[model samples]
Target: MKVVVQVKLTPSPEVATALEATLRSCNDAANWLSLRAQDREEDRDRTRKALQSFAYAELKARGLSAQPALHVIRKVADAYSTRKANLKAGNYGRKDSKRYQRIADNPVRFRADAAQSYDDRCLSWQYDAGTVSIWTTAGRIRGVPFVGLPGAVKTLAEYRRGETDLVHRDGIWCLIATCEVPAADLNTEPDGFLGVDLGIANIATTSDEGEPFAGEKLNKYRRRQIRIRAELQARGTRSAKRKLKKRACREARHATHINHVISKRIVAAAERTGRGIGLEDLTGIRERVRFAKPQRVALHSWAFAQLAAFVKYKAARAGVPFVQVDPAYTSQMCSWCGHTEKANRPTQELFACRSCGVVAHADHNAARNIAVRAEHVWAAVNQPHAADTSGAPAASAAPQGSRS
Candidate 1:
């Protein structure tokens, strides 16, 4: 399992200046190489080797040491590769579309404060002392004090590998290091599943007697943020713009913290219950559903993907068996008697099954449905080759290795 640990650097004024200069120099070089990449792409020869051969010598002469210059070349190459992939994936619409043409015509440009990658040779961590020794244009700066969560620092110290990225965002300097953490063995042959249903009204609802993470507070906060943003936009001043940026970041952090809390609790419950975790595969949901302008604002404001991602990684790390099932009729279908009807849901909060005469919370009923389908999906996938996979109704799990 790969995880990222971030630490903020507290450096002297001189050290900060040197860091700023280093970033500017690297990005300036990158912009220069970006144009070269565009020309090479035009020539139908956009290989990294070709660009390195042509530009590496000049970059060294242009005041970049060696690794930084090489990184600049690779970064530009990666940007172009990403652009190409996005184009191929039809992310920018058709070839004749303006969005596609604009992207294809423009060259990749790196901002001065954009993140720069540093290998082990250029950056060294002193986790015990909470300091780092990093290479800058001014030379190797040692004893740059840093701060991070104690657990994160410990993980970085023990499992940190590969490159660390130095990112400058909102006037803050932080280093994000990649750590290769070992995942626990998956819990095969689970007794049952802890089903989770995600939604806007309730952030998460569980099937185990219904633990609902309400989104009322978050929705109120978002509404407040929206009003403040509207007021700030009306001002159209520099300070207002700055405040908007800060508020945007604050809102995102608040939502992210809430998601982390919710995901941790759900994963912990599954681990303690001796059960697997089941979830709905909500891929392409936004594209599949349309809403009015006001509803769209509410729907798109929250980070559904981030929440799901947190649950998945946490579940994997805890050795809890996890599976996602098709969510075609989880809400409409009755968990008691497998009854499917629109009238089963009398209200947003109530589910009255006509067939089974079972009354339950709408979210709880949906969660139970998801759990049943996930169990069947997991069994079908784990069954022997001769076993009929098509036996499970309205159930299909994503392909995965035996160990997840």
Candidate 2:
């Protein structure tokens, strides 16, 4: 498994100036290569090598360093190749003028290879001792301090160091290190499954146990941000625009933090029970569900994808298997009975099965159904003959009320 750990870099005034200069030079080199590659319209590998050789002397004279220059060339070439491939596959239209312009204005990305640039020297725990150093156009900058190294990152530092990216954001510099960790041994098939239902009202509802993680606070926060953004956008002043940008960054960070917390709790619940985690496959849910304008906006703004991703990665790390089941009928269908009808869910929160007289919270019912379906899927895959008898998968079969 791979994870990225971002550490803030605190450099002196002289080193900061050198870093900016190096980044500018690298970006300029990348833009030049991008234009040349686009105009040539030839094979990518051939073009990349030719461009590298063509620009090597000038880049070296500019004090950009050899490996970093090559990194820029490769980055631009890969981007151009991807765009061309997308166009050929009909995924992108011919009227992609905006995309073309954006490519032309692409900024410099300064990447440091562990081998070439850092010489395989990883950040040490003694970062506070000011012994860490980084190479730059002006020379090596030693005694750089890094802040906020997460526990996971500190552990990863014990292993091999990989490539890192130097990113400049909002007047701050951060080093994003890509670290590889040993994959968890999730070979043990779970005895059962814990279904998780994700929604705007309740961030997550697990089938097994515990109170649902409510999203009321998060919902209020998002609504406030939405109103604030709209007000700033309406003003259209320079200061308002700046505030809008800052607001976006702030909201994104807060939302990511919330997702991490919620996902961790959900995964921990499953891990405690020695069960695999099941989630609704809500892909393209927006297009599937119809709602009023206000509700549609809220649904669109919901970070279901981000929440699911967090749960997935965290579950993997904890050796808890995670599976996504089809969400169809999970909400309307009664978990206790095979009965399926919209009347089963008369209200948003209340779920009472007319057929079996089963009553439960709507979200909890859906979560249970999801868990059952996931277990059925696991059974079908492991025992194909079990499904062959019915000529249909167990999960796809209409729910029959629990046989007494």
Candidate 3:
């Protein structure tokens, strides 16, 4: 598995200036290349090498060396690849829609100080000395100190692999290094599956009747951020825009930290009890769920996919089996009984089954249902093709209730 570790770089004024110039040059060149490639970007395999051949000479003349110039070309190529993928995925709306046309026609643009990738040739890390020797527009800068926790620094020294990105965000410079770590063996015969239902209010609730990982504090923080962002956007001033960027970055960092914490705890719990981690297959949930204007911001503010990613990776590292089960009717289905009726969930928080007369927290009940489904799905997928799964855990989602 691959993970990224970011360390803050404390560079001298001269080195910082050179680093800034390098990024600007790299991104500026990228924009120039993007305009040329957007037309032929659909044929990535054909265009990537062609772009490198044509753009490299011009980039060298524009103050970049051989390696940085090539990196710039690849970066622009990757950007358009991403753009095409997003369009194909209908992220910007239908092909006939104005939003789709606008994004499709326009060339990908990058900010002046956008992060730039550096390979081993351009960057070298010295964890013992907490310093790096990095190539810059003003030539090579050596002994640039990086700040990070002792344990994290140790991990980086041991497992750091591939390229590092030089990012300049809100007056701070950092190197984000990718680390290749080994994943633990999959726990095939897990005791059982621990179902986790993810939501906005109660970030995650487990099937084992554990306390929900509530995001009360984060919700409050996000609310304040939203209000502040609105006020800043209304100001329409340069300083407000700068502050807006800073606030957004701050909120993202906090959210990422929270996701890491929640994923670590959940993975640890599942591993300790020799249980697999089961999650709802919430792919495309944002596009599926409808919400009022007042709730849209709150509902969409949280990153469900990011949280799921954290859990999956952490679980993999801990030798815990992680799988996503179908999420249809989980909310309205009863765990005690297979009764599936809309009335089973009268409110968002409470679930009272009319058939079994069982009352429980809505998310907790849904999590339990997910656990049952996960067991069946895991068995069906893991066993041999001809193996019979007739005895696997199963439930009928048909809306059968006492009222019928």
Candidate 4:
């Protein structure tokens, strides 16, 4: 239930310069590390360590406490190791994605440290405004110029009782907040399980019920992305390189904003129904979908992992149940008669359940089936315990455990 509230920082000119200098120092360390590694003039590990030490000194000089250089060095080394493995696997191209290649070549960059200003938590900042300063911590960061906080800051109680995270992108920061106010009691109890099918085409679908949500707006945003990609690809010049970076930032902002909205709606609907949430056990979905490049890209872009994460945390806050069932037959099985076969879904949209002759939207039927399955799981797991009149776990509900 822990949540983080990312408040925007409005630093003075001096603070802005200091912050930029710190970031550049780390970036330079990365550059120098790469050069040293390529030249083979110094031990790659030793050179990286030296660069990290310098970055740490820079932070100390700025009066902003940061983690020891070794801490950052380890992180960078890990990233480099992982990326190098990816490169060797041939999943990534060199010239086509120079940025990634560079990152793979040199991974370590910066580190964080506990500071009193941010409640003794690691402080990090980018794109600092001379007049405004924003930072994050377990609690609020005070003493900053602003038109008040950009968004509402949650109290400690609220933070500890809900799901939240602080993610940064494009130099502009955000506090991805989730507040779960109690909803009116559901009128009709969920009769059975509801199967959820997640994919690129419709985003999410429930069995029996229609698609609770479709990312049509997001599709429009993707169109803009295509145009931006086309324009960037067409130029292939220095200016285009700069524009490409900006385009990446713009795309990230749009996607985050849209995702926040979509996650909230989807989770809220499940809570309102007072039913368990079901999701496909998308373990290794990427590998399974790799045959179709465009499909892989779309599925990856949708980031169903993030969505499922949101659903999980929100469900816990609402005292609802969630389950990850086998995705193998969830889609292929006919929701009406339990006829589990691929032929049941002959077309993408049409689902004429041959055994029961139930014709419906393919995805919707899948979702309904998922939900129904989840309910059975809930009953099985909690049947031994007495159900409270409120239909929620008792007052001594255990802490919501994470999925790995």
lDDT of 3 by residue, 1-404 (tens): 99878889999898889998888888989898888887664565425698987788999999898999989988887887787889999989999999999998888899999999999999998887999999988899899999998877987999999899999988999999989988999899998889999987688999876578855777788889899999999999999999988888888888888888989988999999999999998898778989888678887777889999999999988899999988888888888766888999998788888777778888988888888878777778886663443322344433222222
Best by TM-score: 1
Worst 10 residues of 3 by lDDT: 395-404
TM-score of each: 0.93, 0.85, 0.89, 0.64
Could you give candidate 1's per-residue lDDT for residues 156-225 as a string of tens digits? 9999989999988887899999999999998887888888998767879998774598567777888888
Off by over 4 Å in 3: 36-46, 87-101, 234-238, 384-404
Q: Root-mean-square deviation of each candidate, in angstroms?
A: 5.4, 4.6, 3.9, 10.1
Name the TM-score of candidate 1.
0.93
**lDDT score of residue 283 within candidate 1:** 88
In angstroms, the error of model 2 at 231 is 0.7
Q: List lDDT for all candidates, in order.
A: 0.84, 0.71, 0.85, 0.53
- Model 4 off-target regions past 4 Å? 26-142, 146-152, 155-194, 215-217, 290-294, 379-404
| Local accuracy of candidate 4 as per-residue lDDT tens digits, 150-193 | 33343322332332233334453333434344533332345344
Tell me the lDDT of candidate 3. Answer: 0.85
Clashes of each: 0, 1, 0, 29
